[model samples]
Target: MLKRHHKTEALILKASPYGEGHTIVTALTSGGAQLKAMAYGSRKLTSRIGGHLSPLTRVELALYKSRDMDIIKQAQNLESFLELKNSLSRMTKAFFVMELIEGFSNTGVGNRPLFDLSLMSLRGLQSSSNRDIEDLTVSCFQLNLLKVTGFMPELYTCVECRSSLNSNNYNFIIDIGGLCCTKCLSGHPGRAINISSKSVEILRQFDKGGTLFSELPLGSTVELRRLLDSSTGFWLDREIRSRRFMEHMNSRDIREPMSAIDMESV
Candidate 1:
């Protein structure tokens, strides 16, 4: 087979320093494949594509294919998602969005649905006005991501018993991958956390556009966040890298907007 030159639209997933002035750029292409390319001189002040290659920017790239990895020859920025980078909350959530996509994606496989989900989630997080909305946005994205990847947990029925979960008591069992009815709880015997019916209803609303976000109280948001955090953590088998930072910042009272410089560095 012969190597060829190709062009594609990609979102920069990672951009790390590689040799002296070159960088290793990992991107998720529009076709949903991971493209790892070396961008020569991208780290230097006067470099041509230096500004275009940062993580989370959408760009078109000219690549030369190789058995080892593709080499990026030219680049042009399509969108910087500057609005997302303008606030700490937005930036942190954006990073979390990217990390989730990157984590679930195969190294060289194409997953256009997952790719589109990532873009949509980023845009949603950017336009959100309040922290509550922002939190809902992230949870919505997580549930959709699970659906797209075929990991969505069961909500309406007992996962183990194949019976309807119409009763008042239901516990979400991470090990069994869904809610277990009170009658079925004794069968699996792993850690089961009791969940409220309100939480269940709200999570189920995710598949239907999640219009309940605005009406949800602070306690509901906290409950939903905890459920997602635990379920996602259980599935991924590790803590989300962006979670600690997001949680730490979330715990503080930074109601006033942060400076632009801090937003960029975040």
Candidate 2:
């Protein structure tokens, strides 16, 4: 018999006290899998691994398989995201984004694109110069996360009718998972998210991996934010808890909570 040693690059998503002197750490490994590992003695004052295991710190780890959970044998800090930690708003946004990633992800399955996106998004949030840019970064991250995870809303046409929209204003139906035409909305009872053509055009660019922060259209942030938030919650089956905290930090109002059917659909 041999001990299983798994080595990976991981982002520490969360950590909680466990046992007398250990911590239960939730990490997103480089392969894009969520792993819960026990870092024994991490709570001790002299522990070396404790410093490297802080939330949002990227590190390389050697994990030994245990009966119920993995045990960390080695940890090397990769990126600490120090700037994000300096601001409550930024860090809360980081948590919100990571929470979304964790919600969509499953254990033991790898999604490289998503892993890279999450890392890049966190760095963007940390290094951003101001709140507006930070907001844009989070929005971009949400939109892109949905894209990578196969939950992207269809913006090109109506989800219900599958018809190309040629109007300056379109309705975003979270229940249907994308834009809806006036014709289709007549048959649908859910609240239709009104979006400008400019917003839709910019979002198309966003989906193509365009500039995230400095390029965001003025006055469209709220609309875009609500759209992504609504659709994401709709698909995920519940409102993301960190969203409220992030919005509070930003002083932005959340226009719509989850709709009745939106709650039922997920």
Best prediction by TM-score: 1
Candidate 2: worst 10 consecutive residues by lDDT? 257-266
Go through the candidates in order and give each one's C-alpha lDDT. Answer: 0.83, 0.83
Q: Candidate 1: deviation at residue 145, Å?
A: 0.8
Candidate 1's C-alpha lDDT?
0.83
Candidate 2: tens digits of C-alpha lDDT, residues 15-54: 8889898999888888888889999998899988888998
The clash count of every prediction, one per candidate, is 0, 0
Candidate 2 is scored at a TM of: 0.88
lDDT of 1 by residue, 1-266 (tens): 67589899999988989989999998889987777899988888888888899998999999898778888889999989998888877788888878777777777778888888888888889899988888889999988888877789998888987899865786899767888887888776768888788888888889766563676866777887888878777778888878776776787766666667545544
Candidate 1 Cα errors over 4 Å, as ranges: 255-266
The TM-score obtained by model 1 is 0.91
**Candidate 2 wrongly placed segments (more than 4 Å):** 1-3, 213-218, 252-266
